[model samples]
Target chain A: MPAPTAEQEQAIRDAVVRGFDDQVRFLQELVATPSRRTDEADAQRLMARAFEDAGLTVDWLYGRGAGDMKGGLVANLFAYKALRAAGLLPEGRVHLQSVPEEECTGNGTLSVMQHGYTADAVVISEPMGEALVRAHLGVIWFDVDITGTAAHAQEMSRGFNALDAAFALIVRLRELEQHWNEITVGDEHFGDQEHPINLNVGVLEAGEWPSSVFDRCHFSVRVVVPPSLGSQRAWEQIEQCVEEAREQDPVVSRGHATVSRSGFFSDRYVLQPGSEAEGLLRELFSDVAGRELEAFATPAYIDSRVYGNYQDVPSLVFGPVAESLHGKDERVNLESVKRCTEIYALYMARWCGVREG
Target chain B: MPAPTAEQEQAIRDAVVRGFDDQVRFLQELVATPSRRTDEADAQRLMARAFEDAGLTVDWLYGRGAGDMKGGLVANLFAYKALRAAGLLPEGRVHLQSVPEEECTGNGTLSVMQHGYTADAVVISEPMGEALVRAHLGVIWFDVDITGTAAHAQEMSRGFNALDAAFALIVRLRELEQHWNEITVGDEHFGDQEHPINLNVGVLEAGEWPSSVFDRCHFSVRVVVPPSLGSQRAWEQIEQCVEEAREQDPVVSRGHATVSRSGFFSDRYVLQPGSEAEGLLRELFSDVAGRELEAFATPAYIDSRVYGNYQDVPSLVFGPVAESLHGKDERVNLESVKRCTEIYALYMARWCGVREG
Candidate 1:
C-alpha cells in the first residue's frame, strides 16, 4: 500500500489542528452525559451522531459501559473526519465501532464480532499516553466470604474473629502477588515493568455489632493475572493460596473461607509484533510525532483482546495520553489527542490505499 | 447479723420454691416485651406491675435498658414477695430499684446514685453463673476511621489503600492487647485467667467499589481494660499503640487515621472483700446452694461499678447460674434462680433485721 501524498498528509494534519476544538467539545458533552453501566442511551446517541457526521455507517451495538472510553471514541470520529477533510477516500473498507462494557466485560465488542462485523485489521483508541500497547494483563475479580463465631468481647477467644482471618488471608495473598511478580520466565512483555501483578483488596465488610467478636467478613479483590499464567491457572493459584492460609494460619484455620469469581474474568492479549498493522502504526506515529514510536505492555484490562486474541486479527491499541482513569478528575490531554488523531488518519489512509476524494 | 431461724429459713425457702412458677412467668413477660435502648417503656411497665404485686414501694427510675436485666429484676421482686409470704417484715427500709443503661453507659445506675439513693450495702444480680464476682474488667469501645486516595487498581501504588492500613493497625492493637495480658504485676484479680485483656474488632467497613483501591475504612473495637490498669491508662495505651502503628507500619504511615470513643468508657471495679455485704452473701450462698461459695474476677463490664466505685458502697455482684448471657437463647437456670431467690431473701431478712409478723 502506498502512503498518502505529502500534500494530503499536510492537509490531514492541518484539518486535525482545525478540528481539535470541536473534538474537545464533543468529548466535553460526552463527559457531561452520564453513561454509567446500564445507562448509556444518551451517550450512545451522541456517539452515533458523531460517527454519521464523519460519513461512516454506524451500527448500534447494545450493552453497558462507563464514559471513560468516550475520549477515544471521539478521537476515532475526528481521525475519520481528518481523512475526509483532506479529500481522500480509502479504497478498502473501514468500520467505526462504539462498544460498551469495555470497562467491565468486553461483551459489547464480543457481540459485534458475533454479529459478523469482521475487519482485515483493527485500531482502538485506548488512551495509552501516546504509546502503543503491545500486551495487557488479564483481570480476575473475586470475593471472599469468611464466617466465624461471635462471642462477647470478654471471651473473644471462645469465638473466632472473621476479620482477623480475613486480614491474615489477605496478607498471604499479597505474598502470592509478590511471588507472581518475581516470576520472569514467560513474562516477555511485562518483565521489565516493576510489580505488574497487583492483588488489590478493594472492598471489605465485616460483623454487625461493636460489642461482640466479628462473626462474618466479606471482601472483594482485583488480581492481575499475568498472560503467561492464564486466568484458569491464576485462579487455581489463588484458590490454593487461600487453602494454604486456611490450613496453616491459626486464625484462618479456625474460620470458614469461601471464594467466588465476582467479575471481569477476562484473559490477557498480546498484539504480536511485526504484523502489517503494527508496522504501519509505527511508521505513522514516528512520522506524525517526529520521534521513534515506543511500545510496551499495560498492567490493566483493555478491550483489544476481543479482536487480537479471539478473532485472529492484528488489533492495534494506540491512543492519547490520559491521566487518572477511573479516578479523581480523570482527563485526556487535548494536544496528545490531536497528535493521535493525525497518526490514526494517516495510518488508515495508508493501510486502506486512499484515492483522491 | 444473726442468721434467719430454721423455721424462718424453711418458710422463706418454701415461699421461693412455691412462687418459682410466677417468677418465671414475670421474667417471660419481660423477655417478650422489646426494651432495646430507648425502647424500654413497655418492659418498664411490666417491672412496675411485678413490684406492686410483690408489695414493695417502687420508685419509677426512668431510663433505657435491655431484657437481659429482667431476670435479675424479676428475682428482686420475687425475693421481696418471699419475705412477705414467710410472714416477716424488715425493720430497716429497703429500696428495690430497677434502672436502665446497664448494658451500655451505666448512666441509669449513675442517675440512681445522683438521685440520692444511698444504701448500707448494694446487691446486683448480673447473671454470673452462680459465682460471686470479686472484680470485673472495664470496657472501652472506640471507633477508628482511616482515609486514603483511591486510584485504579492497576496503579495501586499511586493510592494508599485504607483497608490495608486498617488491618495493619488492628494487628498492632492486638499486640498491645497481648502485652497488656502478659502484664501480671497489676492483674491480681485476673492473674490465673488466660488472655484476660481482649481487644475485639467488632465491626469493620471499608471501600465502595470492587475495582478501585479502597479509599476509606471505619471500624469499631471493644477493648477490655483491667481494674489495675484503669480505663484512663488503658485508653492511653491504645492511643500509643495506634501512634506506633502510624509511625512504624509502612502501610499505615501513608493513610490518615482518626480515633474516637464510641461507647462504654467505664472503669473496672473490685468488690473489696471483708465487707459486711460480702460476709453475708458468702454464708447465705453456701447455705442455699449447699456448696462452698466460689468467687472470681470477671472480664466483663457490670453496673455494680456505679455504686461500688462512685457511691462508696459494697456492691455485691452475684446471680443465678445463667448461660449464654447477651447471646442466642439466653436463659437462666430456674432451679438456680430458686436457690438464689432463697439466698437473697435470707440475706435481706438477716441484714435488715426482720421482725415476726
Candidate 2:
C-alpha cells in the first residue's frame, strides 16, 4: 500500500488519540472484571459483546482447553460481511502469535475496537509496548513424582526415601542447564539464548517416621521452548533426560521418579518476519513510534498463537510496552496507553482502506 | 545393677508388658492430640495433660525456639524417682530417635515410662522391632524454597523458572547423597551402597498459568544422618551445600533463582550400646521372646537419646514394629500390642525391685 500524506497521517493520529482516550476508559472497565480462566463464562461473554459492539460478527465457540480436563473459550471476532466486502477487515481471525495477558487483554475490547475500525490494517491495542514488538515464545509446565519408602531413620535401611529419589530428578534437571544448547528438544536455536527451551523444577514433599515403607513425592516443572517446539514433544525429551540421569544419582537404587502432563500451559506462537502480518505491524508501528522497533521478542507468549494455530490469518502483536502485568505492583504507563491507542487507530484506518483526509 | 533372678525377671517383664499397654493407649491419645510444631498450644496442652495423667512430677516450661521464635515445652517425668530410690530406676530423659513420618517416637510418654521403671537401664518403645531394640537412626526434616522467575516460553530470556533452580538443587542433593552411610547414620548398613544420610526432594508449586513463570517452589527434604551426628552440624553442612549449589545454578547468575531454607526439626539422637539400659532391655526382651534375640541397630532416632542426653539415664529402644503409621490403611496388630504390653510390664516390675514367686 502507498503511504498516506502528512495531513492524512495527522488526521489518523487525531482519531488514534481519540481512540486512546476511549481505550483508557475501556481498559479501566475491563480491569474491573474478574475474567480469570476459572471464570470463563464472563470473560467469553464480555469478549463476544465487546466484538459485537465493535461492529464485528461474534462467534462464541468452545474447544479442548487445558487438554481433556478444562474446556476453552473461543470468542471469534471477524470482519462483518459488509466490512469484508469493502476489504476493511480480513475475513478470518487474524492469527496472532502475541496474545496479551487477560487482565491487560481486557475483555478483548481491542478486538471490538479493531472490529469497529473498518480498515485495510487492523491493530489491537494490547498491553504490549509501542517500544518492543516481535515473534513468539511458548511455555511448558508439568509435574513429576518420586517414589520411595519411609522408615524410622535408624531403620532407613528398610525403606527407600522418596524425597531423595525426587531430588535426583531435580539435580538431573539442573544439569540440563550446562547442556541446554547441546540438547535441543524443539527449535534448533532461537535468536535469543535467554529465551530458549529451559527447564524449571518446582515443588517437593517427603518424610518418614518409624513405620512407613515408602511413598511418593511431587515436583512441578515448566519449560520455555521456541515457537517451533510443541509441549508434548519437549516434555518427552525432558522426561527421558531425567531417566538418563538416574544412574548418576548419589543415592543408589533409592527409588524412581515419573513425569506427568500438566493441565495448565500456553505454547509459543511466532510471527515470522517473512509473514505479511509481521511486516505490516512493523511498518505501521515504526511510523507511530517514530523509530525502528524489533519484533516484541521478549520471552513471553500472547493469544496470537492460538488464533494462528486455528486459522491461517497471519497476525503480529502491536501495542504499548506493558509493565508488571502479574506482579506485586503491576501497572502500565499512562502515556504508553495513549500512544498505543493512536497507533491502533491509525492501523485500523489504513487497514479499512479509508481514503486520505 | 545386679542381674535379676528368674522370678524377679518374670515380674519385671510382666510390669513392662502391662505398662506398655497403658503407654500404647496413651500414645494413641497423645498422637490424636496432634503435637506438630504448628500445633504448639494444643500439643503442649496435650503433652502436659498426659504427663499429669501418667503421674509424673512434671513442670511445664517454655523457651525461645528458633531465631527469635517463641514457645517451647519441657516435661519432667520423675517416673524413675521411685525405682531410683530403690536402686532400680535411672535418672534422665529416655533418649531416642525416629524417622519423622512414621509416627514412632513417644518422647512424652517414654519420658514418663522411664519414670516408673526408674531403672538405671531404660528401654524406649519405638516402632522398632526387637532387632531395633538397642539403636536406630537420626534425621532433620526441611522445607526448602527455590525462587525463580517465569517468563513466557518465548520470552524466557527475561524471567526465571523456579522449577529449574529446584531441579538443580535436587541434583546437587543427590550428589551429596554419596556422603550417606549406614554405620554413621543408622549404625546398620542394611545393604545400602549410599550413605545412610538420605536426602529427599519432594513437592513443588509454581505459576498457576501454564505459560506463566513460577516465581517460587518449596521442596520437602528429609535428611537421614548418623544418630551420633548433631542435627545442627548436619544442617549447617546441608545449608552450606545448598549455598554452593545455588551458586552453581545458572539462574542465579541470570537474576532468576534464590534459594531459602525451612523445616525446623528436632536434633538427631542415638543411645550408646552396652550401657546399663541396653543390657537390661536386652536381657528382658530375650526372656519375653523366649529365645536369644538380636538388638537391631536402627538408622532413625528415638526418646532414649533424650534420656541419655539430658538425664544421663542409659537407654535402649524396645518396642513393637508397627508396620503402618501416617499412611494409607494404617494399623497395628492387636496381639502385638498386647504382647509388647507384657514385655513393658515385666521390665517395670523387675525395676520396681519386686520379686515374683
Candidate 3:
C-alpha cells in the first residue's frame, strides 16, 4: 500500500492540532479517574464513550486485574477520533478494546484474542515516550515464608532463627541472579547487557521483639524474565535455587523455608526485529519526529504481550511521553499526545488502507 | 555468727505469719501500680512507707530503669519488719533501697552505690523461684541501619538493595552467635551449656512496596553476654563481625551499613561459690524448704547485677516464685512471699547478728 499523500498527511496533522484541547482534557480526566487494580469500571466507561464517539466498535473485557492499561486505552480512543474527524476513516475494521486484568494477570487481553479480535498488526499505545517499544520482559512474583523456632533471646540454642533463614534465601537469590546473568549472555535478544533480567526483593517483615528469636519471616520477590525464558522454566530455576540454598545450611533446611508463586505472571513479549509491524512503526515515528526513533525493550510487561504472544498478532507499543507511570504525579505530555495522534492517523490510513467515499 | 536458735527461728516465723496479710496486700498493690520505664515514683512511695514501718532506713534511688526490681524491694521491706517485730533486729546496718532505673539503665543503683550505701552482702529479692541465682548473663542492645542506592526496580543495576545488605548482616550475626556460643563454652560460671550467650534480631523492616528496590532497612538486635565476656569485649567482637561482613560483598560495603550500640548494656554478675553470703542464703533456703536449692546462671539481666558487680557487694538473687515477670499477668505467689519473709527474718538474725533486745 502507498503512503498517505502529502496533502492528506497535512490534513491529519491539522486535525490533530485542532483536537489538542480535547486530547489534554481526555488524558487529564482519564488520569483523574483512577483505574487501580479491580477498580477500572469508571475508566472503562470513559474509554468506551470516547471510542463510540469516534465511531469505532468498543469492547470492554472485564476481569480481576490491575488497571495500568487505562492511559493507553484513552490514547488509542482519541487517536481514532482525531483521524475520523479528518475524514480519514480506514477501510479495515478498527476494533478498540478497553481490557481489564492486565496488571496482575493478562487474562483480559488473552480473552479478547481468544474471542477473535484480530488485526494485521497491533499497536498497544502504552506510555513509551514515543520511542516504539518492540519488546518487554516477563515478570513472575513469589512470596517466601521462612519459619523458625521462637524462644527468649537468652535461649538461643533452643530457637531456630527465621530471619536467618530469610537471609539465607536472599543470599541464594543473589547467587541465582548472577548465574542467570551469566547463562543468558549469548542469546540474540536480551543478551550481554548490563541488566537484561533482574530479581528484586521488594518487601520484608520479621519478628516483633529484639528480645525474642524470630519465629516467622516473610518476603516477596519480583523476577524479570528474558524473552528466551518461559515462566515455567524460570520458576523451575528458582525452585532449584531454593533447594540449593536448603542444602547449603542445616539451620535453613530445619527452619522449613518455602517459596510459592503469588498468582501473578506475565510472559515476555518481543516483536521480531524485522517484522512488518516494526517496519511500519519505525516509518511513522520518523515521519512524526522528522528523524528516526530508536527502539528499545523494557524490563516491564505491557498488555500488548498478550495479543502478540497468544494470538500471534504482530504487536508493538507506541505512546506519548508519560512520567512516573503507576507512581505519584503520573502524567502524559499533552503535546506528545497530539503528535502521537497524528502519527497513529497516518499509520492507520497507510496500513489499513484509506476508504474512498 | 551462729545459726539462729530453733526458738528464735520459731518466733521470727510466727512474726512472718502475723504479717502475712500485710505482706499479701503490699505485693498486690505494688504489682497493681504501673511502674513501667520512667514511672516508678508511686511504687517508690509505697515501698518507703513499708520499709520505714519495718524500722529500717529507706533510700530512694531515682531514674529510669527496668521497674522489675519493685517486687523484690517490697519483699525485703516486709522481711525486715517481721524480724524487728520478733525481737530479732540485727546489730549490723540493714539498709533497704527502693531503686529505680534497672530496666533500661543501671544508673539508679550506681548512684546509690556512689552515695555510700554499703553492705556486707546484698540479697536481691527478685522473682526466681527458690533456686539461688549465683550467676546471670549480661545484655547489649544495638541498632543496625543499612543504606543502599534507591532506584526503580526496572533499573535494577543502578540500585543497591538495602534488604540485601540486611540479609548479609543477619547472616553474619548468625555466624557470630555460633562463634560466641563456642567461645563462651569454657566460662566457669556459664560453661558448656546449650546457650550461654545469644544474639536475637528482634525488629526488622525494609521497602515500602514489593515493586521497588529497598533503599533503607533498620533492625534492632539483643545479645546475651556470659559472665566471662564483659560488655566491652562483646561489643568489640560484634564490631569486628560487622567489619568482616562489610568485606564479604561489594554491594554491602558500598551500602555503608552501620551498627551502633543502643545505650542499654548490662554486665554479667557472678558470685563466688561457697561465699559467706551464698552459704547463709543456702542454709536459710534449706531450712524453709527442707531441701537444697540448686545454683544456676540466667540469660536475663537483673538489678542485682549492679550491686554485685559495681558496689563490691556479694549479691545473690533470691526471691519468691513469680510467673511471667515483666509480662502480662505477672504475679508473685502469696505463700512464697510469706515463706520468703520468714527466711529473710532468719537470715537477718544469723547474718547481721541479732542484738540483745
Candidate 4:
C-alpha cells in the first residue's frame, strides 16, 4: 500500500485534534467506572455504546487491563473514527477487537484468535510510555498453600507455624527469582536491563487467632518468565523450588507447601526486529511523533502474545505514557494519548491504503 | 468451718453421680454452639439456662476461654445442684460469677470485680490437666502495619515488598521472644517450665494484585509475659524491638512498621503458695481424687488475673484435663470433669460451712 499523501496526513492530524477533547472525556468516564475483575459489566456496556457512537459495527464483546488497555482502546477507536471523519476509509478490511481479562488471564484475546480472525499485522494499545515492546515476559500465577501443626502458644514448640513456613518458602522463591534475573543479564533481547524478571508475593493470608500457632497459610505469587525460558519451564522450576524447600529447609520441612496454578499460565511473545509491518509502523510513528520509534523488552505480560506466539503474525504492542499500571493512583498522560491516536491513524492509512468512501 | 461428715461426703459423691450425665450433655451442647469472639450471646444464654435449672440465680455472661471455661462453668453449676440434691446448703453466702471475654480481654471478669463482687477466694476452671496453676503468663496483643512504595512488578526494583519487610520484623520479634524465654530459666514458679514466654505470629494480610509489587501488609501477634515481667514492661520491650528493627533491619528499614495494641493488655497473675485457700483446696482435692494436688506454672493467659492481680485475693486456676484449648477438635475429658465436679462440691461445702437445709 502507498503511503498517505501530505494533504491526507494533515487531514488525519486535524481530525485527531478535533476529537481530542471528546477522547479525554471518554477516558475520564472510563477511568471513573469501577471495572474490577469479574465486575466489569458496566465498563463493557459503556465501551459497546462508545463503539456504536463511532459509527463502527459494534461487535460488543468484552484491572490493569483497565489501566493500559482503556486509554489504548480509546485511542484505537478515536483513530478509526478520525479516519472516517477525514473522508477516508481503508480499502482492506480492519477488525477492532475488544476483549477482557487481560490482567488475570489473556483468554479474551485467545478466544478471539480461536475464532480465526487473521490479519497481516495486529496492534495492541498497552500503556508503554510511548514506545514499542520488542518482547515481554509471560507470567505464571500460582498459590502456595502451606500447612503446619497448630498448638496453643503456651506449647508453641509442639506446633510448627505455617506462616513461618510460608515465609521461608517465599525466601527460597526469591532466591530462584534472583537466579533467573541473573541469567537474563546476558540475554539477547533483555540484556542491559537490570532485574528483568520479578517474582511478586502479591497476596498472603495466614493464621486466624492471635494466640494459636498458625496451622495454615496461603500466598499467591506472580513470576515472570522470559521468552527464551518459556512459561512451562518456569513453572517446573517453581515447583522444584518448593519441593526442595520441603525436603531441605527446616521450617518448610516441618510443614507441607503445595503449589497450584491459579491464573495466567501464558507464554512469552517476541516481535522480531525486522518485519514489513514494523517498517511501516516505524515510518508512520516517526512522521507523527517527530522522533524515531524506539523498541525495548518489557519484563511484564501483554496481550500481543496471543497473535505473535499463537498466530505467528507480527503484533505491535504500543501505547501512551502511563503511571502505575496495576496500582493506586494509576493515570495516563493526555498528550501522549493524542500523539498515539494520530500515529495509529497514520499507520492505518498507509498500511491499509485509504480509498473513497 | 467443720469438714463434711463421712455420710455427707458419701451423699456429695452420690449427688455428683446423679448430675454427671446432664453436665456432660450441657458441655456437649456448649461445644457444639459456635461461640466465636463477639458471638457468644447464644452460648451465654445456654449457660444462663443451666444455672437457672440448678436453682442458682443466673448471672448470664460470656474462646480459648471456651475450651477451659465452658466445661468449668457447667461443673460449677452442677456442683451447686449436687449440694441441693444431697440435702445440704452452705450456711454462708455463695456468689456465682459468670463473666465473659476471658479469651480476649479478661474484661468480663474485670467488669464483675468492678461491680463490687468480692470473695475470700476465687476458683477458675481453666482446663489444665487436673492441676492448679501456680503462676501463668500475661498476654499482650499487638498489630504491625507496614507500608512500602508500590510499583509495577516489571519495575520491582523501584518498590520495596512490604511483605518482605513484615517477615524481617517478625524475625526480630521472634528473637525477642527467644530472649524473653531464655531469661525465664531458674525462676521461682516457672523454673521447671520450658519456654514460658511465647510470641505467636497469628493473623497476616498483605498485597492486592498479583502483577504489582506488594505495598502493604498487616500482621497481628500475641506475646506472653511472665508474672515477674509486667505486661507494661513487656509492651515497652516489644515497642523497642520493632523500633530497633526499623533502625537496624535493612528490609524493615525500607518500610514503616507501626505497632499498636490490638487487644489483651493484662498483667500476669501468681497464686502464692501456703495460703489458707490453697490449703483447703489441697485437702478437698486429695479427699476426692485420692491423689496429691499438683501445682505448676503455665505459659497461658487466664481470667484468674482479675481477682489475684486486681483484688489481691488467692485465685486458684484449676480445672480438668483438656486438649487443644484454642484449636480445632479441642476437647475436655469427661472423667476428669466428673472428678473436678466432686472436688468443687466438697471445697464449696467445707469453705462456706454447710448446714441443715
Which residue window of length 10 is worst by lDDT in model 1 chain B? B58-67
Q: Model 1: how far is B30 from its true place, Å?
A: 6.2
Which rank order by DockQ, best down to worst? 4, 1, 3, 2
Candidate 4: regions farther than 4 A off: A1-5, A55-67, A355-357, B1-4, B55-66, B355-357
Candidate 4 C-alpha lDDT tens digits along B267-329: 877889999999998988887788999998887888888899888999998888877766665
Give the per-residue lDDT digits (tens) of candidate 1, residues A1-357.
556788888988898888777777677777777776687788788888877777531111111111246777877888888888878888888798987777666788999999999998999988788888889989998999998876667778777788878878888998999899888435788888878888888889997667777678999998898767888999999999999998888788877788999877888998888998898888888787889889888888888888988889998888877776666556677677778888888877888988888
Residues A119-139 of candidate 4 have per-residue lDDT tens digits of 989888888978899988899
Ranking by lDDT: 4, 1, 3, 2
Cα deviation at A317, candidate 1, in Å, is 2.4
Candidate 4 chain B lowest-lDDT run of ten: B56-65
Query: Which of 2 and 4 is ahead in lDDT?
Result: 4
State how far residue B20 of model 2 sits from its true place (Å). Answer: 12
Q: Output per-candidate TM-scores for chain A, rounded to 2 decimals.
A: 0.87, 0.64, 0.84, 0.93
Compare the candidates by TM-score and give the number of the best one. Answer: 4
Task: Tell me the spans in candidate 2 whose CA falls farther than 4 Å from its real position.
Answer: A1-36, A39-146, A150-158, A161-195, A199-214, A220-287, A292-300, A323-333, A350-357, B1-123, B131-145, B162-196, B199-210, B224-283, B324-333, B353-357
Backbone clash numbers for all candidates listed: 0, 136, 9, 1
Clashing pairs in 4: B63-B66
**After TM-score superposition, what is the CA distance of residue A174 in candidate 1 from its true location, in Å?**
2.8
Q: How close is every model to the real structure, measured as TM-score?
A: 0.80, 0.63, 0.68, 0.94
